[model samples]
Structure formats: structure tokens, C-alpha cells
Target: MPHVTFIEHNGTAHTVEAVIGKSLMEAAVDNSVPGIDADCGGACACATCHVFVAPEWEAKTGTRNEAEVAMLNFAAEVKPNSRLSCQIEITAAHDGLVVHMPDGQH
Candidate 1:
């Protein structure tokens, strides 16, 4: 498992270990981390699982795919680091990954 940190727009942080191969959205939802609504249940159809990948961890998380970038247009406060959490897979290299939830998501 890789440890992930979810920080709410208001600055609350929840850290948990995510099962290998699981989506980042699943880890956040499983741990009851605030701000990740995940209304589409890990599907790329929804932008409710929006997150801001910390700058330091950006390279490890990878860029958004075509579908993900298209869906992000529907999300509020989209930023350069915005990503659909469901599209991110956990790996050992992401052990210290940190993400920030947008104010809209909260």
C-alpha cells in the first residue's frame, strides 16, 4: 500500500494507506476524506473527484488523459495541477503523495 494525503480546501488533512492498484478516489472515499465526492464512483464521467496534485508530486502522478481533460472543463476552479482523482493509480513511488481539494469540491 502507498500512503496518500488528502487536504481539504479549508486545510484539513487526512492521511491513509491506499491499496495497491486502487484509484486515488477510492482511497479518499474509503477513508472518508472530506472534499472528494466521487459521485461517478471512480468513473471518468464525473469531475466531482477533482484534486490538485501537489507540485512536488506532479511527475509521479502523470498528466490527465484526453477524457479526463475534457471532463475537467465541468469542474470549478480548474488549475494547472487539477486532476480527476479516479484517473490516478497508486504506486510505491507515490508513497508520500499529497493532494489538495478545490474549494468547489468542499
Candidate 2:
């Protein structure tokens, strides 16, 4: 399992043990991390799972897919590191991964 830290817009941090092969959104939802609504249930159909990938972990998280790119258009405060957590599968390499949530979901 990988341990990921989700930092809220206000600086609160929730660190959860994420199961490999599961999506980041699932990890957040499973641990009840605030700010990650995961409204589409990891279907890549909504931006409620939006997160900002830590710069050092960006390469490990990989590039967003076309569907994720499209869905993120609906997210608030999109930035260079913005990503739909549902699109990122967990792996051992992602241990210590840290992500930030926006002030609110769109």
C-alpha cells in the first residue's frame, strides 16, 4: 500500500494508506478525506475529484488522459498541476505522494 497525503486548501492534511491498483479518488473517498467529492465514482465524468499533484510526484502520476482533460474543465482553480484523482491509479511508486485540494469543487 502507498501512503498518500491530501492537503486541504486551508492546510489541513489527511494521510491515508492507499491500496495499489485503486484510483487516488477511491483512496480519498475511502478514507473520508475532505474536499474530494469523487462525484462520478472514478468514472472520469466529473471534476469533483480534482487535486493538485505535488511537483516532485508529477512524473510518477503520469499525464492525464483525454477524458480526464475534458472533465477537468469543470473544476475550479485549475492549475498547471491540477488533475482528476480518479484518473490516477495507485502504485507502490506513489508512496508518500502528496496532493492539494482546491477551496471548493465545481
Candidate 3:
């Protein structure tokens, strides 16, 4: 399992052991981490799973796909590193990955 840390807008951090092959959104929900609503159930159809990939982890996390890019268009407080958590699958290489939630989500 990879250890992923989720940071909230208020500066709180939730570090959880994430399972391989599962989406980051699922890990957050399973671990009861705050800030990731995942309203679309990892379908990539909604922006409730929005997160900002820490700059250092951006390359490892990779770029957003078309669907994610489209969905993020409707998200709030979007940034260059913004990504839909549901689109981010967990892997060993992602250990110690850190993601931050926006101040608000639409």
C-alpha cells in the first residue's frame, strides 16, 4: 500500500494507506479523510473529487485525461495542478504523494 497524504484548505493533513489499483478518491472515502466528496463515485463525471497535486508529485501523477479536463472545467478554484482525485489511481510510485483540496468545490 502507498501512503498518501490529503491536505485540506484549512491546512489539516490526513495521511492514509492507499491500496494499489484503487482510485485516490476511494482511499480518501474509505479512510474518512475530509475534503474529498467524490460525488460521482469515481466516474469522472463530476468535479466534487477535485484536488491540487503537490508540485513535487505532479510528474509522477501525470496529466489529466480529456474527460477529467472537461469535468474540471466546471470545478471551483481550479489551478494548474488541479486534478480529479477519481482519475488518480494509486500505485507504489505514488507513496508519500500529497494532494490538497481547494477552498471550495462546486
Stretches > 4 Å off in candidate 3: none
lDDT per residue, candidate 1, 1-106, as tens digits?
7899999999989999898899999999998987889998987998999999999999999999999999998887999999999999998899989999999752
lDDT of 2 by residue, 3-76 (tens): 99999999999999999999999999999998999887988887999999999999999998999888887776
45-106 per-residue lDDT for model 3 (tens digits): 98998999999999999999999999999887889999999998898999999999998767
RMSD of each: 1.2, 0.7, 0.7
**What C-alpha lDDT do the candidate models reach, one value each?**
0.91, 0.92, 0.92
- TM value for model 3: 0.97
Give the lDDT of residue 98 in candidate 3: 95
The deviation in Å at residue 84 for candidate 2 is 0.3
What TM-score does candidate 2 get on C-alpha atoms? 0.97
Error of 3 at 60 (Å): 0.8
Better of 1 and 3 by lDDT: 3
Error of 3 at 83 (Å): 0.2
